[model samples]
Target: MKESLYKRIARELAQQISTGTYPPGSLFPTEMELCEIWQVSRHTMREALRELTEQGLISRRKGAGTRVCEPPTSGVNHPLSHLEDLLLLAKNNLRVIKKIDEIVADIELSQLIDCPPGSRWLHIASIREDAQNPDAPICWTDSYASTDYARLRTFIRDDPHSLISDLIETHYGIKSHEVHQTITAVGVPKKIAKILNVEPDSPGMRIVRRYRDRDGKVFETTISIHPAGRYTCSIVLKSQNSGE
Candidate 1:
């Protein structure tokens, strides 16, 4: 298989933007310049720009041309990176409420939390609502915590707005040494769709996160399913001295 010329151009340009070759708040090369450099038609250049824009890399204005976007404060970059950027992008315009319960873990969940099958655990379910329309649901999240850390129950219950890692530090004196996140696309389950106000088979993004403490203890695991149009993620890599 071969990459199309326009896609190749788009990928190369995206890389440049990600690598700081095109720093934030800086103008990108003009479309005519890109056309000349890539030796492509005007439409091809425009298509490449469109691809970059879709990835949240740059913004274009009719009179001002295209400028590289600043990494979003609420996205994968800033101090609150783990918390999704709910303000800038429409996809994340939702509020979440947490519900706590106790449950016995099944095999799949047991493996995720490093517990034996059928282990008792505290489960927290979070429902997300569209900010614009309170009636619209956008995401559903479920988190499992080891029963040994019963002290965390109060922390989780009290701080709905705090990041889980932050809560762990505040209450348990356990600081997260590393965080692992995985994302996949799946069809919404009927139960979740009913809450999200979408068809049962609607597409969605599923994010699974595993939190580890300083001593390598797995403290929490969370799974979040977001409606197709209601969430997105971005990663920004900067050179050590780039000061981004």
Candidate 2:
């Protein structure tokens, strides 16, 4: 079947973005201009732009025309509606390590990471930042890795884009069968607030992700705190019988 006109236009716009023809933060052509260029109706152009917005590729505002934006990991707009978007988050941000230490999980730590109290863990503190804007950190993260993967510290220090669970799978053959995630609204702690360039006790979102192996063992857990206004999470819901 032939692709719909709006879908074709959306694909063309995405390609233009990927090729840097329309760079991030650059203003996209107005709806009228786009309609004229493609010789399509206003409704067709609107749908085309809507498709790009849903893909996290552009932002639209009443006074702001349309603006090309970076993928979710850059914090312009984060769409958690699909697995691919989660992978994109890991691919786009670079995690810069600040410190690493081996310690036994105490009661508080165990509850925080959802691990056993007595289990040994390698605590890795890092700050993730957008590759394009490294000076302004995106979030402060605390990662806890199973002691079995202690060598991950060295590898993680050397590489920034690779997730620890992925590295564990690559080096130790421990595949991640599932991931448990939780999101909470919290305040930015004073200790890491300065690093994240946010004030202490400011509104923030704390995201906790735990990667579990086939046997349901948690191998890696990361808690990330993103300041408000720096991140926006968009969830898309589809109808079960939307085929019609």
Candidate 3:
């Protein structure tokens, strides 16, 4: 789809502002001048200018025209690029093993992890804490790995890079090439809240990730809980409908 006149004007102005064409603390063109320059109606000009105002690039006043402000801070924001990025981030945290169990995937479990009902698997309970401060918990993860790789228990305790998918590739040569993730916000559960050191019923982020190999077989699934403000996930999306 083609860009709208207002969006095109807004983007052009934003680019100019970012490039210092319209320097900070400088006065912007009057509404009438902008309308004449863009050959657009007053409504279109006002809408385009509104975009810059909302983005904190320009301010409007009764006496003073729109004045440019300093650009917003660009730090403290990160995106989850892909499985590799997520796996790399795991190395920065410490996973303390809680216990391991063998279980049958009942109806609830099958639906939760998209696994075959009644199938047996290994359930590993662990808490990931910030390496900088062990007392500051990051998340509690309940992981299910294919029972065939149960022998990995020996290395999981001592290995610094002990992500289940990483262990599978190391031990079985089945490299995971993709990850499917789902995030939800919910009230903290009793078991997870205790592990994360937060009060019961506190707001939390529940993340479920399935690691799959080249053939799309999900060999590892992890359900993790992070207390409010402890962990965050970010994503950057491209405009799919744009004629790129």
Candidate 4:
């Protein structure tokens, strides 16, 4: 497996743009200049530049030379560094428990949580509010955990700041080895809309997280719904070569 010369050039240029070497609105080298510098033909240089243009990294015109554009960043506010950060989000907020019930997952619930239809679970429903601004709710969350830890219900009600997964680990001595998450754009349901004080079918973000134990068995599933502009998720990525 070998890398093509044009693609390699495109990657190098992209790195420069990302690293602010060629900042936004700055002029980029001309095709002839790049061809001469890289010792490549006009076609190869054109292809490389075209790749960057298509990625919205740069713009070019006949008379106006190519210029870098502002790099796009995901609308993020809080940067989650590790599992503790994830738990901190729940611990820092105030969760007002709406209801707790024992149930068997039906067909729809099974698909949503990625669990068997006949699985028994303890469902805890709550609304998270900012500690300082309790008047404005943040999101609605539904957490389903294995009924084996039903004793956790009392503790959950008493401790509104602790996450169920954390509680499970504390009481049952079972730790989460990994967590799988999925985020989707959805409309706020009618029931949730009223509670959140938003319009029905309004824009919302649906986030589902599955917590697994060391045995790779899913022990808990949580679904959270946040109104548009209410929450922003962020993550930092690094390259292996950059020893930081």
Best by TM-score: 2
Give residue 34's error in model 3 in angstroms. Answer: 44
Error of 2 at 42 (Å): 25
Worst 10 residues of 3 by lDDT: 72-81
List, residue by residue over 111-210, the lDDT tens digit for candidate 2: 9888778988888899878656676677888889878887887888777887777778878898877778899999999999999887899999999988
- Model-by-model lDDT, in order? 0.69, 0.80, 0.76, 0.80
Give me the overall lDDT of model 1. 0.69
What lDDT score is found at residue 70 in candidate 3? 74
Cα miss at 244, model 4 (Å)? 11
Query: Which scores higher on TM-score, 3 or 4?
Result: 4
Instruction: For each candidate, give its TM-score against the true structure.
Output: 0.59, 0.71, 0.66, 0.67
Q: Give one digit per residue, the lDDT tens place, for model 3 in 1-244.
A: 1246776687678667756789989999999999998899999999888766755668999897789887434311113544544543465567888999898999998888889899999999988876544665778888998889888777688785558778778778888777889999988898767767889889988889988888998998999887777765666455878997
Candidate 1: segments with Cα more than 4 A from true spot: 1-98, 238-244
| Between candidates 3 and 4, the lDDT winner | 4
In candidate 4, residue 133 scores what lDDT? 52
Task: State model 3's lDDT.
Answer: 0.76
Give a tens-digit lDDT track for model 1, residues 28-124.
9999999998899999988778767766778999999889999654312211132322222312333355567789988987876677888787787
